[model samples]
Target chain A: SAVISQKPSRDICQRGTSLTIQCQVDSQVTMMFWYRQQPGQSLTLIATANQGSEATYESGFVIDKFPISRPNLTFSTLTVSNMSPEDSSIYLCSVVFGTGGYEQYFGPGTRLTVT
Target chain B: AQSVAQPEDQVNVAEGNPLTVKCTYSVSGNPYLFWYVQYPNRGLQFLLKYITGDNLVKGSYGFEAEFNKSQTSFHLKKPSALVSDSALYFCAHSNDYKLSFGAGTTVTVRA
Candidate 1:
């Protein structure tokens, strides 16, 4: 299993402000992903953070709203831009590791509350 | 297109009783099903997965899941429930390295 950690475990920010969440893995991983979980809802994939390149975002999410940066295999960041009340959610960092990379491990999410 | 469904929103069980969380999947090819648990204010923890071979796969925390291809179901099970087993459970499927998660089921095991 891969050990993952995230910065700013919980944060409260004013609306229209931006916050960047950092994700670090103990070891190199093949794939890194960011997810969002609304209050009392299931997880939704936000984007795939690719090392040394731009992140691949899922539909309903765009780079302008959530910019991602993956400088290397062990580190990545997701920035929530122009946040609003609806942006208040738990953002999670997940990675795929191990032999076939079938299992994905998640970091203790960053809980953001946009006021 | 590949996805998993957790029909029940919540499940209640007593300590030492059998606990089951139902999950059914729909995919174009062979399914790669997985179960994960999330405690209060914590990240998700992988419990078990069914890739191939064994229909019954055992995982951490004494949890197991049976994959029934005929029913397109991979339901998580535990012979005896523990109070600590109370958490939110998710069923997911992987397609092209991307995961599609179910709506999640909240399990409450009361002592």
Candidate 2:
């Protein structure tokens, strides 16, 4: 199992402000992903962070709204740009490791509250 | 399109009683099924997975899941429930590198 951690565990931000969340993994991994979970909602895949390439975002999410940076195998960042009240959600970073690396693991998550 | 369905929104079980969380899937090919648990204010934790071979897979926290290909279902189970086992549970299916998750089921284990 991979140990993952995120910064800014919980934060309150004003609307229209941007916040960046950092994800660090204890071991190097090839597959990293970002996810969003709205209040009482299921997890939604935001993007797939490639080590040295642009992050591949899912539909309904774009780079302009959520820019991602994967500088290396062990680290990545997701920036929520121009936040709104609706942007208030728990953002999670996950990675795939071990054997075939099919079993995905998640970090504690960043709880953002946009006022 | 690959998808997973968690039929129950919530499952309540008494402590020491057996518990089950139902999940079904629709995928083009053989599916990689997984179960994850989320405690209050925490991220999802890996419980168990069924990639191949075993029909019943055991995982962390004494949890296990039976993969029934005939029914296209992978249901999470526990022989005995604990109050600490109460949490939100998710069922997921993976195809290629993309993994899709179900809406999730909230499990409440009462003592």
Candidate 3:
């Protein structure tokens, strides 16, 4: 089990503005991931934050739109660039700890509302 | 591609009665299935996982899951439901360090 936290628990941003969500883990983790959850919907993986490298994005998501940075094992950030109303969703950060890597623990999530 | 499905969008049961949330998954190799619960305004909490070697696995809060490889199902069960147990549940499968999650099922236990 891991303790994960996200900054700016809830935010309201104007359209065309960019927002960066921070994820911090209590213990060092092997894998960190970013996800998006639409209103009353399931989660969609946005990217996997690789330490000291670019994030691996899933289909329908691009780096230019959702850039990620993982400077170390315990911290990562996901920036949603040029946001729109459609980008208003709950952004979550999850991490896999230790050797097993089978289970993932998630942060409380950042609720971004683009107006 | 690995995928998971939670057929029911919502499940309603009476408090103190037994409850089950259905899940099924598809993967190329052996499956690493997991169940997580999400309370309102909170993060997803890991309930249990089935990597191998056990048909039935118990987890926190007296919850358990039975992994039936033949049916490709891993259903979460609780012997007695509590009103506090009402929450959104997710079924997920892992492959290559990435997880494929189901749409999620909202469980409502009434007292």
TM-score of 3: 0.98
Sorted into a CAPRI-style docking class, model 3 comes out as: high
Q: So what's the TM-score on candidate 1?
A: 0.98
DockQ scores of the candidates:
0.85, 0.80, 0.84
What class would a CAPRI assessor give candidate 1's docking?
A: high
Q: Model 2: per-residue lDDT, tens digit, B1-111?
A: 679999999999999999999999998777888999999987899899888898999999999999998999999999999999999999998766567899999999999
Model 3: clashing residue pairs?
none
How well does candidate 3 score on lDDT at residue B98? 80
| Model 1 chain B weakest 10-residue run by lDDT | B92-101
Can you rank all candidates by DockQ, best first? 1, 3, 2
Candidate 2 on A1-115: residue-level lDDT in tens?
5689999899999999999999999998869999999999999999999888899989999999999999998999999999999999999999987448598889999999999
Please give each candidate's TM-score: 0.98, 0.97, 0.98
Off by over 4 Å in 1: none
Model 3 misplacement above 4 A:
none
lDDT of 1: 0.94
Per-residue lDDT over B19-56 for candidate 1, one digit per residue giving the tens place of the 0 to 100 score: 99999998978888899999998899999998899899
* lDDT for each residue of candidate 3 in B52-99, tens digit (9 for 90 to 100): 897999999999999998999999999999999999999999887687
The C-alpha lDDT values of all candidates are 0.94, 0.92, 0.94
